[model samples]
Target chain A: MNAAPSASKEEKNAMSSMETPDAELVARVREGDRNAFRKLVERHRERIYRVALGMLRNPDDAMDAVQEVFIRVHGRLTDFKGESAFGTWLVRVTVNYCIDRQRRQKTWDARFVVDNEWEGVSEESPEHQLVNAQIGEALQRALAELGEEHRTAIMLREVNGLAYEEIAEVMGCPKGTVMSRLHHARKKLQVALRPFLEEAGERDLADRAGEGVRRRE
Target chain B: MNDQDQEKLSLFLDGALAPEDAAEVARLVATDPEWKAAHRALKLSGEMMRAPVEQAARSANFDGLWAGIEGRLPAPERAPSLLERLRAFLTPPVLVGLAAAAAAAAYVATRPAPTPAPASPSPGLAATPRIAPAPESALAAAPADASEPVVIEGIESEGSKTVLVSQPVEPGGTTVIWLLDAPDAAGDGAAAPTTDDDPI
Candidate 1:
């Protein structure tokens, strides 16, 4: 497992959220210690924020989802059951909530251009930040463009860094299904980010926009 | 790279592959340009996803997250249940009814056994006027002003009729007597009609 590259801030966060036993904090909260809930919120808010940001793709909406997710977990404290990692449970809750929120919001902002979702860097900005921001915007658009389940699959695996089994458990799908989703999700991402990858020096992205998968066979 | 090759690559990247399989994918990627570029593209996808996380962290307003949730959290105090609310509103009327019932009970319990008719003798019933000169209950609730003595001039009761009486205590002021019914029992001891009667 350690051979997996130390990839992103998200993986680092998943590691930290587990370093301390969430069961202990969860127990404290259930024992009527309200401030313990503050500790709980602090521990998982970032991951929750990231998932919401990934699913909702709006800063303000993601922030709102963070608070709403915590409040929801608070009300259902008794229902946590310690069956899954509190973090995974939170992601499940967040994904379901964002899907429902999007339905209620009815705003499928599916524009995958590399500029619309860029917030931290602009095309006119310095080349380094601009490149990362474009990649980021492309990723956001591409993620938003997938079906809800596919988007959730990638978010859980790539964004939240959950294991295949953990993703299966959180998504209530079989491991094979999880594997298939992740495979397709990444393939579509590879297709979508082909331009970025080529610019980053992965010359000759197989023309797999449609029949790309059959080529791999 | 076929689906099996790509799936093995994914397993290798995520460290989900067995050692032999990971070493094999590593060997293949080392020798194959196609697998190498596919691996690079997948890794780039990961980095692209991280861009948003980093960017969001740069602009996220999460400092007040706990406070926002806390501010809206319904205090642990539960909303009163239906029975609780009913009891809360039912208190005054119930107490008033209990007070009137208690007063009648106490009056009944203290009635002379011989059934003396103090007012007028009717065939089966007579008005018994109980004049409490210094009512203990009235005095207990009276103000500190000792100048005017609180009096229960007369308490009259017939079979089911509640009788009210008025007596002129001061030269021009007449004290209006009140009675409690089964309904308005709360007004029995409170807000009684008062006049500037000079005598007790």
Candidate 2:
């Protein structure tokens, strides 16, 4: 009995892996197939949610923005001409919605002074292998300090891993402007992270030296 | 750094520099400590920016999302079921007509022809009776009993003298009522009734 069930599970996994690619899935979504749309949301939601979270720096806001992004995509699926990758299109939508949310939050902050006092531990000690959890918290803090446009450009280029041109497309700006924003963003991040870099550098250098010596002998 | 070198360095870091430009940057970084330091700083910034840090926030829930979408859409109007539509298409309107014909046949099937009503002797008047009497004629001028036909019995005139008028009636139980009085003679000077069969 166990053998038969395991075999069936393996077969199902294999069959799923052989199923439609993202492009075909998107096409089916455009044809109004809800299941296909769900597949698309599943495939790209992680990156999209990450990008939104990076921009908004709040998980709740990111969730709302992601939901709005899908709703908008469903509304306009017929207009998607397949000129760009579905991932790229979704990332663009996600970025724009987050930026809008950021603007609204800023307006709210201006009228009512709300402090992010609950902003908790910026570092995760060894028990967490969570990549950049510490860095992410620190980055979020650093990002919170920048203007919305600059922060969004940085998130798009860095987190979404979009090329400068793609970022430009999403941002509705010239490539030169994108470069300017990114250049400024780097300067800002370096300023924010200088102490962390200083503390980590000496240790990283020592570890690298030990590895080099081990290789030599 | 020279403007050309700076441009080349930026392009190289971006992986957009041509092969020759890339080679030049690589050579400069290898040879010059200043170039190496700048390159290291630039690369570090790039990696820091690209750090795959925080895990993604949970994405929109599919079921909740669809529920919200459904809530926003208007409810569709109820349509007739397939069987009802099919039944409507099959039934003909003239079936009512068929039912009337069947009833008439059934009545004919059950009854012997009723004894013919006795015929009355023809009146002495030589002229054919009109479907409606001429308005100018005196006999036509008599106040007609709206409730009675030709020779109404037991009706006492509520006003001036009443005259029995003969009027042909239509087959489907339609009765024509006419009241004739001279405009000058009637106490209320309403206009004399016209012979014109003009519809009221």
lDDT of 1 at A4: 20
For candidate 1, the per-residue lDDT at B97 reads: 97
Work out the TM-score per prediction: 0.62, 0.52
Error of 1 at A133 (Å): 8.0
Candidate 1 lDDT over B1-200, as tens digits, reads: 78778778877878878988889899888888778778987887776565666676666777778889999777765579999998897788898998999999998689643212212112232223333333445434544433342333334345333233233334434332322221133233232212211222
Highest DockQ model number: 1
Q: Identify the runs in model 2 with alpha carbons over 4 angstroms from their true place.
A: A1-40, A58-61, A71-93, A103-145, A187-217, B2-10, B29-32, B49-175, B182-200
lDDT of 2 at A186: 57
Lowest lDDT 10-mer window, candidate 2 chain B? B121-130
Worst 10 residues of 2 chain A by lDDT: A108-117
Writing each residue's lDDT as its tens digit, candidate 1 over A1-217 gives 3222234889778986766578888888777667888888887888788778766767788899999988898889899888888888888888888989988977655342244335534554475565656666676567777877887887667656778887788788999998888888887777776676567552234333336777666
Q: Give the TM-score of chain A in candidate 2.
A: 0.65
TM-score of chain B of 2: 0.36
Candidate 2: true interface contacts recovered: 0.14
How well does candidate 2 score on lDDT at residue A149? 76
Interface RMSD measured for model 1: 2.9
Displacement of residue A213 (Cα, Å) in model 2 is: 5.4
